[model samples]
Target chain A: MPAIQVTNLHKNFQTKRKAVGLRGSLRSLVRAEYGTVEAVRGLSFAMDPGELLGFIGPNGAGKSTTIKILTGILFPSSGQATVLGFVPWKQRRQLAYQIGTVFGQRPQLWYHLPAIDTFSLFGKIFELDDRETSKRIAFLAEAFDIADLLETPVRKLSLGQRMRCEVAASLLHKPRLLLLDEPSIGLDVVAKQRIRDAIREMASLEGVGVLLTSHDAGDLEALCKRVIIINHGQIVYQDKVSALKRTFLTSKLVEVRYARQVAPDFHIAGTETLKVAKERYGVKLRFEARQTPVEAVMARLSEVGSVVDITISDPPLEEVIAAIYEQAERSEAAIAK
Target chain B: MNEYHPTRTPAWILLIMRELKFLLAVWKTNIASAMEYRAAFIAQMLGMILNNAVYFIFWVIFFDRFRDVRGWELSDMFLVFGVAASAFGLAAFLFGNAFYLSEIIARGRLDYYLSLPRPILLHTVASRSISSGLGDFTYGILSYLASGYCTWDGFGRFLCGVVLACMAFTSFMIIVHSLTFWLGNAAGFAGLALNAMVTFALYPVTLFEGFSKLILFTIVPAALMGALPAEFVRAFSWGALGKLFLGALLLLGLAVLVFHRGLRRYESGSAIQVEV
Candidate 1:
């Protein structure tokens, strides 16, 4: 059976609305007004068992709201969702025993206690006896590389270290699926890379399904096979991650620093130089890989001057996703017109 | 992974045992967390004791000036205050989150409880310990002793009264706070309700007669929590005991039902909150 199945899920929030200033505040006190916010609108999707699916969206796009509904933390306004063959809202407790969750913005570790204390507590919460709990803790501590850090109070650990402990704690019960909402958020580059690598390793080793939601597209590129891009509380794009890259990640950027000073009029064909180093020894350029071959660009650069340093990469995923967002918005505008 | 779950046992008993185990572990962790700031814990606990002592002194002075008001003497004040303080303190210490549940709901902290595989209301209410509750409990016991009704039977009744009052008080707070699910951010209103309950609970039932007495019995139910319970402790009557028992059970049932009803309408906020 699929690890997750959501059909036409809808969530609406009733938000209090008050006008500005003293007069408005007094009027609201007498008869408060409220407005409706459709946070998630008719979202539908399914994930095969053990599949690493990326649910990517910008802020307020209903990614977290959908995840919350799937986890049974928030009830949907309408529609159906099942996790591990159990209806989420009705069978939340049963589903919880079979799934784990990590909310990056909400740390589950007790701030004043050591990570191990929370881990031990979780073992009990999941109904593990002392010996079994100890064995499981050792296993997870090793898996998440949190052995050395577990004894330190969560308040004392760095954000990255605390996050590792948080993830490890969630896995204490050996759940079949892991739902992570923005797991790499607010981490430094190295921390983000470490988290992604560890998550990938754990998923592969245990065959645990992962449904990850993030605004960071890098998280999708590094970890997931299939990707779903949501915008304005709706899915705008869904496909294999490779397909996303092939269709939109067509441009390449290169930065080269020459050992010797290059000529000022130095120009390469079919490539646009974005910036020149103040010392005149380095230049940054971009070219569509479709239009200009990377091998040709490399040969031309070598022909220009002796190369000291070079870096080649695709445009950051944010830029790529932004492009899709613009296309979706324009199409939506057309439909409205 | 599935072997850890024992499936052969009777379902309801197993469910109760598992939830109880989880509760114990959570309570243990809460105490350890409180001890992390030992100095602050001690200070808060002692400060509460001092605060309650000052309030008790006011009663002592009032009774000295006026010997008895409507057959309610200084001793009666002691027993009522003892029941009220001990009950409030016990509720605070055991279910500290009940006091600030509205704020937690408003700030989205309930997410932590909902994600776990345990009873949400029990876990959320019992996850924290109030350091000062110990002090209040101590003060209550001292007040009960000074009332000169410290017989073995009277003490048993006092203990029973405290338990019932704690149930009523905590469940009342839970019901008030659960309104946050319908009314957005009801923390301020909850605080007002708490103050009203505490104020009305400390006064003698004789002080208010017609409408005010009606308010105490039904609306705020302070009479049930303090005066009625105190009267039962002073001399146990089957009728009074049954009334207090039924009242506490009814309030507790209402609390659980209201909270679960509110849970359906819970609109979790995006306001960033750290689980401490």
Candidate 2:
């Protein structure tokens, strides 16, 4: 059975429309207006056990709303969602015991207390016995290289150190499923690498199903094999990371450095030559793949001049995601028309 | 085959023990953190003591001008003030987060408690500990001792009063906290209402005759939290005690019902993470 099953889940919020100033406030007191916002609309997805899925979206793309519903933090207005064979919102207690959550922006550790104290608190919260709690804490602390910083207060620790502690705190119970929301936010390159490694190790070694959501493409690239894209309260696409790259990215930029400068009008059918720059002894050409493959582009470049160095790279994930959103917008408009 | 039955342990006892364990763990951390800022801790404690003393002085002067009002002596009024202040302080110290429910809800901090494997009220109250409430506790103990109200029977009555007072306070706090589910940011409104109750409650309810007394006793129930408990101390009446107990039970039931009902309409705030 799938570890998580969500079917047409929906959530809407009614917010009061209050005006400014004393007059408006008094006016509101007499008769206040309310506006309804549809946060999640008929969202449906399912994940198998031990699957590592990346839930990616823009700021208000309903990624967090979906996660909240899945984790039993918020109830859906309509439809059904079950995690581990139990209804999430109805069986929150049971779900909480089996799942762990790490919110990167919010360290679960009590700010005033040392990281170890927070770990111990979670231990008690989950009712883990002393022996098992200590063993797990020790193991995670060492793996995250936060053993030395265990005694340091959370407030005193740096963002990277606090993040490590937060991850350790979340795993003290050895939850069967882990939900990490922006676990690499506000961390340096080294810290991000460490977090990615830890997440990879946890999923592979412990067999814990992982759902990660982040704006950081590096985090998605490093830790997730499967990517799910959400836009405007809907999942537009979900597939293997490699497949997403290959399907969305049609053109790969191939920069070639020549031995001598040449004013070559590099005319290739089904391809646009974007730019040309002359170096002291070399020429560089930037092109977009209209119909030709990257290999063909490289071959054409080779024919044009002596290629000293060559590199081919696709557009950044940010651009690809933006293009996807634009494509979605255009399609919606077409359907409306 | 013999029928199997489950043993029935009192729910309050179980709740108390769970809360005690949770509080002890939280308190240890808070105290350690408090020690780090020794000067700030002392300053805050001193400020609270001074605040309470100012109020005590006002009562003293009022009683000096008019030795008795509504046939209640100045000393008796002092006793009421002492008990009410201490009880309020203790509740504030232990469950102060109840006062910040609106902010927590607005910021989505309540998501943590909602997601936890425990009652939302218990989790929210236990999330933090307030050290300033110690001042109220101190004054209460001192006033009970110095005012000659600490007789053997008075002690027993005071014990009962303390328990009932805590229950009443908890009910009030829960009711206020639950309002956040409906009135998104009702902290200021709730505070105003609670302050009004406390103000009237710390006085002798008998002073107000007829409908006013009924209003205090029933609608607001401030009189029961204060004057009624004080009356029990003066003399035990089964009828009066039963009335107070019944009132508490009813209010508690109502509060819990309202909270759960409002929870149905609770729209959690943005998923933006919050730090405690």
CA lDDT, candidate 2, residue B258: 77
Candidate 1, residue B198: lDDT: 90
Which pairs in model 2 have colliding backbones? none
**What lDDT tens digits, residue by residue, belong to model 2 across residues A56-141?**
88878888888888878888889998898989888888889899888775567877768888787777777777788899999998
Stretches off by above 4 angstroms in model 1 are: A20-27, A30-32, A258-267, A295-310, B1-15
Instruction: Give stretches of model 2 more than 4 Å off.
Output: A17-31, A258-290, A293-295, A302-308, B1-20, B27-36, B236-241, B271-276
Cα RMSD of all models vs. native, in order, equals 3.8, 3.3
- TM per candidate, chain B: 0.92, 0.85
The DockQ score of candidate 1 comes to 0.75
Q: Ten residues in a row with the worst lDDT in model 1 chain B?
A: B1-10
Name the 10 consecutive residues with the lowest summed lDDT in model 2 chain B.
B267-276
State the iRMSD of every prediction, in order shown: 0.9, 2.5
TM-scores of chain A in all candidate models? 0.91, 0.89
Worst 10-residue lDDT window, candidate 1 chain A:
A273-282
